[model samples]
Target: MDSISQLPDALLLGVLSLLPAKDVVATMILSKRWQFLWMFVPKLIYDDNYQNIEFERLSRFVYRSLLLHEAPVIETLHFIIRPKSNVVDIGVWTRTAVKRCVRELIIEMDCSSSSTAPVMLPRSLYSGCSILVKLKLKKVVLVDVTSPFSFPSLKELSLKSVKYPDEEFVQSLLSNCPVLESLVVKQCPNDNATIFTVKNSSLKSLVLENQDLRYNDIGAGYVIDAPSLEKFKIRDLHEDRFCVIENEMPNIVEADIDVAYGHPGKILSSITSVKHLTLCITSSKDAYPVGLAFCSLVYLEIWTLDTEWSNDLNLLMCVLRDSPNLRALKLEQLDCDGDRSCWMEPSSAPECVIWSLETLELVDYEGAEEEKKVIAFILRNANCLKKATISTESTDPNKRLEMLKELELFPRRSPNCQLAFYYSP
Candidate 1:
């Protein structure tokens, strides 16, 4: 490979830093240290095929290769602009030669018509304690914040399909990012969510996807008030004004929600300190909201379908009187009716006969016998129950597993529960 332009300029600026800075400035006549190591390669990846070229010859070769780079700390400046109109400012002279050693700034623009022009962010990046951790933006719009900004070692921040309709400029750009932890906002605007009221105790992983959030209107405050938040994910909720118990963000342990209308229900103020909860109920609920509680939920997954529920046994007896630290429970596509009476019976069978349940899964169960006596009254009252699995798709499978082995008044596993039967022909 000695023929590879006689190699070395740190191996041809690491293969022209993966090409395209106009093909690494045409590999600088392939000599003279690749014409000064392709303007001091520190990562400035740009794409969108550099937009049909010729934006004044691509702004005079990225402003003469950032003025023949004398090295000013450029370590990652990815751009993928796709603007045809909006009065083309052409990213204001290559972001003013990225003055302060730009430490990671990615902007992925895509404008289709509509022009007012005044949006050219990348100025008040990071000062004082600047380490510019990591920032990802899509369809970005942060019209320069007046400049007392800070990035005191910013952390992971991802905002996709953005649109910020001033909430004091999104809380003055998140109150100057004072040690912002992992925060991801997908599909924003209409107050482009990230509304943390004062208390920023160093946020810890919060994500709001496709949000229409309206929080901290005081009294019913908080879009986020991280007391060291712990992994929270809210996915695509068109509207119902994005409520998570009034934007409390309760010291989450881990939660993934998708809600639009659980009504005066999603008022989940205190999650009893979550422990893995995944709820993907795409609206159309008949009942799953009786002031739902998680009482320290411990692994509970419900995808929903019991005929889209009308009360799925009063939402499974409100998770047995509010999850007494539940221990693994998965119910999917449930909708039984062989006279299991569909809950509400004597207060949901004394809240599913008291719990602290341990493993109870029923997927697509339909061989109703009162849903097999509510899975044998939750294995004869979940006294630290161990197992109960019933799978059904159906196929003369021992007539629904021998009609659950001839009912036998419940006893498939008692010395601490354990009964398995899967059917899928």
Candidate 2:
């Protein structure tokens, strides 16, 4: 105990910062030297489920700790409020954290178990806190703000299941953050914003996950104008929505798009410069725009759905034809219940298969007749192919051996190509 106590106060506070707020405060009981050490810890995390404490007790503890904390700058202030907790108390806690120069603030409300309404954050939060570098809010309501404010230091922001007042408010809030580099938005059903517009020039990464369950014919969509984006991801399961990109992302390095939208030509044309892409669309017939080429695409992953085989094959051939520099390809069979349609070979091999293609992977391989035809065509045409891996979920050893034997009989154009098989199940 004496040796531990001899360590510097800064080192002791560092250790306390890793623990929960309640545990940090309990360290005061160890010795007189540690009595006031917890007050200087830069990070405070308070979760109601941590100790199963009552709401009232947790509220009081947060209030008292903020009042006594002596840190000049709170690096992080995280809170997980219970559903029935007082909104006024939450406002007070946020105001206090802002005053303490909190850099990273996270407030998550658990509303899944209770029928209480979403907690509206204090207006002071939107107006103040110029020093905040990162902010994350979940299950909260963002009311309209008339006051002018800007988060000059904020670089990362995440909003999950948040309710917004209107489209203007959403645009105004994003416009205020001039230098935000990363943004994540998970939309809720009927959240009032019909078209979410993000026009940030400095944004380098963006993730959009839309869970909107509205069945009406009223169209909902997104307008993205982030030209500096290096990485982009979107997962929209609703087929009624649309996406419009205002500018091309020349610097984009990777993208993951899984949408059910009918026509995604505009979205596809904007991301032609991506080096690595993962794509899953509802309809692939109109997947590419006219004269659009993926000159920079090096790695491609296509998620095949349980749909018409001809459409899926057409999409695959169209992309492979345009991606002249593609080096690696992955086909993930999400479902294998499609019709066993006859496979028709392309008139000519794609430039990628004859020139740069090196690695191929087929996940969830079912060894269907159509699947075998597609695999045989790639092996016969890919002159630069180095390795091919087939992962199957079949449990029968005899079926697996027969599948391997069929694949081995296919003619390979590359002399050094190695074929490997795995039974996943």
Highest-scoring model, TM-score: 2
lDDT by residue (56-125, candidate 1, tens digit) is 5665666677667655676776766655422234445335534636667677665553632323454544
- Candidate number with greatest lDDT: 2
TM-score against truth, every candidate: 0.29, 0.95
Error of 1 at 46 (Å): 18
Weakest 10 consecutive residues of candidate 1 by summed lDDT: 213-222
Task: List the candidate 1 regions with Cα displacement exceeding 4 Å.
Answer: 1-156, 159-176, 179-182, 185-200, 204-227, 230-250, 253-272, 275-295, 298-324, 331-361, 364-378, 383-425
Q: After TM-score superposition, what is the CA distance of residue 114 in candidate 2 from its true location, in Å? A: 4.6
Which residue pairs of candidate 2 clash? none
lDDT of each: 0.61, 0.87
The clash tally of candidate 2 reads 0
- Cα miss at 245, model 1 (Å)? 26
Q: Residue by residue across 1-425, what tens digits does model 2's lDDT show? A: 88999999888878888999999999889999989989999999998877789888998999999999999999999998887888888888988888889999999987656664677888889877898999999988887777787888899999988889898888888888999999999988767778989999999999998855653235788999999999999988887888999988888999999888888777888888999999987666666677779999999999867367767877888899999999999998745574645658899999998999999999999888778877898999999999999999999999999999999999999999999999997
Ten contiguous residues with the weakest lDDT in model 2: 211-220
